[model samples]
Target: MGIRSVMLPAAIAATLCAGGVARAEGLTVGFSQIGSESGWRAAETTVTRQEAKKNGDTVKIADAQQKQENQIKAIRSFIAQGVDGIFLAPVVATGWTQVLTEAKDAKIPVILLDRDIDPADKALYLTAVTSDSVHEGQVAGDWLVKAVGSKPCNVVEIEGTVGASVAANRKKGFDDAVAKDPNIKIIRSETGDFTRSQGKQVMESFIKSVGGKNICAVYAHNDDMMIGAIQAMKEAGLKPGQDILTVSVDSVPDMFKAMMAHEANATVELTPDMAGPAFQALNAYKKSGTVPPKWIETKSTLHTSQDSDLQQIYDEKKNLGY
Candidate 1:
């Protein structure tokens, strides 16, 4: 991975030490969430809050509830409270400069989780922790290519939110991999906002417009959308995994159930362990005056129908909300 580095001034370093555990309640953190929209997102919030409770750290939790303005308001409030650190799951990559700049001017170290901000001003924030979205997308695309072999395929894509890094990077990775295989063509593509209802609605339209036989597969940015598409296929009197090849990111329980039932082919894993590493970084930076790289890429896994371990994890994790 390429380096995305940020440097803190020595003068600020001295101030950082002054606001140590005694002053900030031993690593008080302010966390801003995008929203509990999908299973993966819910898992992320659940894991983060649980980790904070386990550590007995004072964490101010703010739910943006899928609104960028709400996220901005919560962050500014965290800044006002003089929290030791800040964590932001930005709604949109752009338009974050003002709020991030506010944190910087206040000398508060900021950690980005999940999504990322525009790289035009790298010094405005501390670092980010997120999945390698491009790689995850490529995994899905590659799996589809191998499964279908050289057969001509027509595919429809259900995209996530626009302008988000996950949406952009995942799309780029999938397109790059699919481009290598000339026989596969994307017949239709639309945004589902990473929600089940939206995914189902989009699939309904695709089925009506192109009919079931024309589409060989469905590539959704997340599992929720894929699940929605699967329902639409069933209602249209078409099989999902068998009649139309399906692949997506996020190995939620429903996807596993679909895989077991032979309605969904495969999914790449997105773990809720994101907060553990972020908090570890924050603790290290605070206690020892250590600064991490600007970008910390989280790990992911690809699960096919053959992986028993995936099925186990899926079954266990599904019941627990994120």
Candidate 2:
């Protein structure tokens, strides 16, 4: 994810050494989460704690409930407590210069998960562990193009929270990919705020404005929104997969279940184990003063019901707290 459409710089540097490395032994790390707004966020928190346990680190988690103010407050609290490190899943991209600068002044390293901060000043954080959201969106768009072939398809888009780096980047990737073919056109688009209720509400408005039957597909930034869109489609007396193709990001359990039921098409996997790499970087930096690369990328895999065993994947990820 980016404050810009492009990815962050890939330069590895000693900027991480600005804050003295963490002390050996059980370290206390504060985590400022974006909140359990979706299944993926919940699984991310769960996996973060699991990663902390694996590293014998004490994680002090603060739920921001998807507010920038709450996240800034949580980071200040972590700094006041003098935690060894901080894990921040930023609710939005900009307006972070002040708090992040404060963290730097306190000599606390902040590792970003899921979202990236504005690169106006990259020195504020240590490093970011994130997936290629643009690529994820491109994958979704590519799948839709191939599925529809040369047939004219009108798509309604369910976007994530506005101003989020991930949301902007995903939209850019999808928009760019779909631009390659004039046959695929996005007819309606709105922000779902990355919530199911808002997603359904937006889809409902889209259906009324555009004539549901005229729309060929729905592109959601996340699976939760796609599931909500599917519900809206069903309630409106339309078969989801058959009547309107569903393509979204975030391969959560419910998405796979919908896939098994043939209600959704494809979802690009946004792994919840973001903490795995964040903790790894923290540990390495603490133990031996290792400065990891500026951006640590996690793989984004595309899952489709048509080519894969949806049930087996659902069974594997159902217990993952998503």
Number of the top candidate by lDDT? 2
lDDT by residue for model 2 (280-305), tens? 99988888999999899998888887
Full-model lDDT for every candidate: 0.85, 0.88
TM-score of 1: 0.77
Query: What is the alpha-carbon lDDT for the whole of candidate 1?
Result: 0.85
Which digits, one per residue and each the tens of the lDDT, describe model 1 over residues 16-78? 545543553557889999888866788888888777777767677899998999999998877
**Candidate closest to the true structure, highest TM-score:** 1
lDDT: worst 10-residue window of model 1: 1-10
* Quality of model 2 by C-alpha lDDT: 0.88
| TM-score of candidate 2 to 2 decimals | 0.75
TM-score of each: 0.77, 0.75
